[model samples]
Target: MAQAPPMNVLEISAHFRVEHDKNRRQFSIRLNGSHDKAVLLYDYVGKKTVDLQHTEVPEAYRGQEIAKHLAKAAMDFVVEEDLKAHLTCWYIQKFVKENPHPHYLERILH
Candidate 1:
C-alpha cells in the first residue's frame, strides 16, 4: 500500500504553489501576479542527502509565515523523494524541531 503524503501537501496555501526548480536547486513560492517570492535553497550531497542551505522571503512578504510554507514544501519534497535532509537553515531547523512528524522526522540527518 502507498503511504500518505506529508502534511505539507494538504496544509500549503492554495494561494501559492511551491515550485521546485531542480536545475536551480531551490523551492520557491510566488503569489499570483507578483514577482516577489519566498525561497528555500538546497544542495545535493551525493545521491541521497540534501543540505537545506537557506530560506529567503522578500521584505514586503515578511511576517506572513511564508518561510514556514517554504519549509513545509521542502520537507514534503524530501519525504516524497525518500531523501535525507541536513538542515543548515536556522528557520528550517527550528521548523523541524518544533513540528515533528512521525515518518518525516526520521528523514533528518544529524
Candidate 2:
C-alpha cells in the first residue's frame, strides 16, 4: 500500500499548524497564532523575552501531547527567528526544562 503523505507543519502568519484526527474528531494546535489564544508575546521593555500560552485543550484532545507539539513549534520558531522567551506559560517552562536548549534560555531577559 502507498504510504500517506506526512503532515507538513504549516506556518501561519505568526504560528504553525499541526492537524490531528481523533475518533472522528478533528483538532489542531495553532502555535503562536494569538497571545489572546496561544502565541508568542514579547515584553514591554527590551522586547527580548517572549511569553507562550496554551489554553486547556478540548476534552477529546486531552492527554494527547498536542501541547508538546505546539511547544516544540514555539521553540523552533525561537531559534529560527533568533528570539528569546520568558516562558510565562507552564507547559513551555516544562518543555524548556526537558529540551535543555541554551539558545532559548540564554538570551532570556534577566
Candidate 3:
C-alpha cells in the first residue's frame, strides 16, 4: 500500500532520551512531555547497519501513524550519518517498499 509519508511522532525535547528497555527488549524513545513523544525502538546490529528489528505500537497507539513516525526518525538518522542501511527488520523492509523514492534504497538493491 502507498502509505502516507511517515511523520515524526518521536520528537526532540529538552529531556530527549534513548535508552534500552529491558522489559521491551528494545530501546525506548522518550521525552519529558514537551512536543515530543516515544513512538519507536531500534538499535545497532553492525558497524554500518542498524537493526530496526522489532517495531511496535501499543494497541491504543495504533493507527496514529506511529510506525511511520518511527520510520521517519530511523531513516532520517541513516541519511544524516551518510550511512547505508541493511533492513533485516521486516517492518523496515516493508517501510522501504512502501516509500521508494530511491533515497532510502541500499546499493545492492539498485
Top-lDDT structure, candidate number? 1
Best by TM-score: 1
Each prediction's RMSD over C-alphas, in Å, is 6.8, 11.3, 10.7
Which candidate would rank higher by lDDT, 2 or 3? 3
Query: What would the TM-score be for candidate 1 when compared with the true structure?
Result: 0.84
Candidate numbers sorted by TM-score from highest down: 1, 3, 2
Residue 48's C-alpha lDDT in candidate 3? 63
Backbone clashes (count) for model 1: 0
TM-score of each: 0.84, 0.55, 0.58
lDDT of 3 by residue, 1-110 (tens): 87554333334333344443433434345434444444445555556655566676666556655566566667766776666666656767778888875767752122
Better of 2 and 3 by TM-score: 3
lDDT of 2 by residue, 1-110 (tens): 98664444444334336543222122246534543222233232335445554434545555756566666766665677577656666877887788877776674543
TM-score of 2: 0.55
> Cα lDDT for residue 28, model 3?
43
Candidate 1 regions exceeding 4 Å error are 1-11
Clashing pairs in 3: none
lDDT of 1 by residue, 25-101 (tens): 88888765588888899999969999999999988888888888889888888998999989999999999988999
